[model samples]
Target chain A: MFAPRTNRLAVLARDWLRRAVPRSVRVEWVRLRRLPRWILEAPLMARARVEDPRRDYPICLAWHESPLQRGLFEGETELERGKAINVAIAASRLDGVRVDRFQVLSYHHLVGRPSRRRGFAPGLELHAGEPAVGIGGGCCQVSNMLYLLALRGGMKIVERHRHALDLFPDRARSIPFGLGATVFYNAADLRFENPLPFPVLLRFDVRDGVLRGELRAPEPPDFRVEVYQEGHRFAREPDGWIRENWIRRRFSDLEGNELRDELVAHNRCRVCYEPTSTQTDEESRAAGPR
Target chain B: MLRALVKGAGLVAVARVPGGAAAYRRLTRDVLGTQRGHVEKLRRVVPGYVEIWRQTLERPLEGARIWIHEAGWTAYWPAVCYRLSGRAGAVTNCEGRIHDQYLSRAIAGAIATEIPNDLNDPRRIRRLRALLWARQSDELFRTLEGTLHERCVPTNLPLADASRDLCHSGGVLEHYRPDELAAFARECRRVLKPGAIASHVLDHRDHLWHADKAYPFLGHLALAEPLYQLLHGHRRSLSYHNRLSPEEVVALFEREGFRCLALRRLVLPERIYLDADEAARRGAPGLSRRYLAPRHRAISEADLRTAAAHYLFQKS
Candidate 1:
């Protein structure tokens, strides 16, 4: 959480820390640090190898695409985070691997923790509702995408953690807000079990600024699963803003007949955003947290 | 971490070595360039952002016989490249973008009617077929051999009256003096087809900010004309930079008989001293006094404060 605006020193300090080092020095330092990481991570990386890919599965479970961002190239901090997304995706990809029946695929286990040594450059991360630079910043985006894939595929969720904050606009959203997972290496994770009788094939890659993913199995699910969100609201609180939503899953037969409906989750996240057009003086005053 | 920090500190220390500013600048530039390169590689992996451009322009770049104020196309690829590929994705190193899922599907719809399958690829797509114009006869401007028309001054371009559909320029009109800008506007009106669009992006800030980031946009206003010319009057320096503000630019375009469609100041962060604050400081009263003088009766402190602006005008 950031200090209130009355604390001018905190604001100035944040700005200073951002541009403190010349872009050149920061870049060179990151690269120099990478040289030794290869030696440190050699064994662990060698052991966690991506299996050779083979496309024998005939049925498709789910596919999702998270598009590239816009206006991301204007600043250095953003540029670094964009690089981290690619690095994380490359590390997380399960191109040639298969999750056998009733097996749990640990997100952290497959992708490992993306870091400078593992070729992840700096990326933007949320620190108290403000943007900050950290190693492996955008790695969670890969987890979010996979979580959506599993949610729609009706896979048994083993462990998943939603973000403590939602910092983006819902302008061009496909998967409902609050439907994905937030992750960190070795601690927070996104894990799902394949309940099907056969193994499911995993395919994911960063293609042309998009993270494209598809899950394949020997046969498709008998029931159709559709995930949606409800009761989404942004409230003006005494401290900051809170955005919350409810995620629900609906099951239906292939013949378009609805079968079952279930409430999946209630997610509340803190975000730093100003909704001037929507939250007017009266509305914001009314929407304030009791 | 400590070692890298020490190295960075040592580099900064060398930069502060009384006469080490130039050396420091060189080192800083090199380091920033490498960082940019690393990020640029990631950018290329993503898609382009022509949708923002399309939105800002208020229309797809389709079906226009366009006339550009200046076309130095060799180094900049956005204009020619977009026309060829029609997909913003066609541009390279556009990350923090390319959000791939959004791009691959959007690339199929060209703002113009041209389809990707119609041509082998972007390189093979010769031109907009809709026509392109420029005041310079540069080979790069000529996507097709006969496409460029550079025979006359911009004030009286060789193009026929009402023949062009659009006129576009970015940060170029501010380079002209007031009289030259009026003439250029008049010429644009003369050549533009009836009701055509003229989009101009103006940078009203002092160019000195490029050299010194701490300098304010209106920092140059503190200098009197004589002092300014003496310091940066040489053609090689800042002589081409005009002092016209956003208000003056809009007034000039309107006087040329154009109806404004969209005009707004770009909101940029105030990184340097505010003009009034800087003026109250020592040795900075010249431009302030000039701005308040009899000849500058029309200009106001507020007029000078608008750092940058974008104008979408239509021929009346």
Candidate 2:
């Protein structure tokens, strides 16, 4: 609930600061913000151990994949390469991990802090609806995939953060807008618990220009999960133009009988660029994204 | 031919899509109306429980006080005890956590619906069925509910010392680590009457192979010790296995003041070989000693191949 004038001023200020500060200094500042939470959550972290994959893996509950390096926008080649490197590093730590029933998988705990010293390169990160180059910037894609995997796997999401700003237009977006999670180290962690009676495996593979993730189990799961968006709307607010959507999940038995439909998240984010169909009136309208 | 290969690959890719496995199971199980659960398999095993008890006791199971350790969520042992002994004897169902009444009732309903014909006694079946039928009317489930008695301080079992005539479990020991087995054995000794009998079935093979048919039976033995321990050493692991040989398990019990009366090891013929090198020469995968963890490599080939063991012991 911000005034439109104040929101404009805040946006201008953020843009000015982004240009004034060096990327290294900004990276250090972000790390500093995360330090306290990192120290506090150190003992509660779950880590993956080095073990050969089991032969009889449970049937996969869900699987998702995205192009490893799309390089859709001009001058994104270097950032895309850095992002792939960061993702590969994180995937090695997560692939073939088994989360037993009642066990929680913490994204930051498993992936650790992604810093330049740890071989993470300069990747594109969005700050206040504007893209900038920063260390470990593109790891958000990994967190996004993990969040969706947990949702489809029927896991209980313990903690998650939604991006406050919509940075880019969908060129060839497969998933819904604002459906992804934004994680910032230990502070904004992506955590989910396996609520099933059987243990679930988190398998990630980055190969042949595809980053694939799967939630697998030792046996076929009895229920099926479907995630969809509801009540999607674009509103012109006193602060600025914003998009909102209710993301929901439905669970059904293998027989196609509905078990439960639950609200996963309600996302509302400020739009950085001009939306094609912007409402001049104050009333909210149910409209699809352009 | 190339088109067919491409089609096959495309199908495989589609099968890996999100929600594909569940969709496939639904299509086959629900649409096709197939009974794919373990219900049929469990029905076959339920009758054998009485035979196992008779063999161990060398007499009828009637009027025998039984102590079952770690009956798990299903309360399978208590169900079997009720079916065999009815009101003649009582069972002390000891476990780390409380049993789920709904699941226990479901099991009882399944058992009573089709009392296996092999049980042979119409009188026992009639009484057991009637009692199980009455469980639905009771607000509190009385099928396995009783006063919990704990005499030993801090022990997992809640029963008086020398109060129980027999202690038994099936497929429960391998879940305990080697160190844990010693502690469990000590607890068993304190609960049972002097010279009382204890019988247990322990699985020694890699549990992963049972679920995944393609996995080698001894594949777990080939891993580096630290890696295996890191993965399945945690108590919450579903595929947790101590990987102890039949002899090692017996020795551990003997150390805990129990005399091992019988150690029956069941080995698979195809899994048996003269030595690791010989097995590898015969193209027996996962039998390579060079890849085995150091501790497992020290075990005899015969012992390593033992898939399971049934032990009968007496308190010394």
What candidate 1 gets wrong by more than 4 Å, as runs, is A1-55, A77-92, A127-130, A276-290, B1-316
Docking verdict class for candidate 1: incorrect
Candidate 2, residues A245-269: lDDT per residue as tens digits? 8888877768896665667788999
For model 2, the docking class works out as: incorrect
Candidate 1 lDDT, B138-252, residue by residue in tens: 3223433323443235465566688666666655677666787898889789877777778776667665554444555555565566765554443333234577766677788
Q: Compute the lDDT of residue B174 as modeled in candidate 1.
A: 72
Residue-by-residue lDDT tens digits, candidate 2, B45-118: 44544455566664356656776654333334455555555532233333232233223233444454344455
User: How well does each candidate superpose onto the true structure, as a TM-score?
Assistant: 0.38, 0.44
| Alpha-carbon shift of residue B222 in model 2 (angstroms) | 55
Summing lDDT over every window of 10 consecutive residues in candidate 1 chain B, give the lowest-scoring window: B89-98
Mark the 10 consecutive residues where model 2 chain B has the least summed lDDT. B132-141
TM-score of 1: 0.38
Q: Which candidate is the best by TM-score?
A: 2
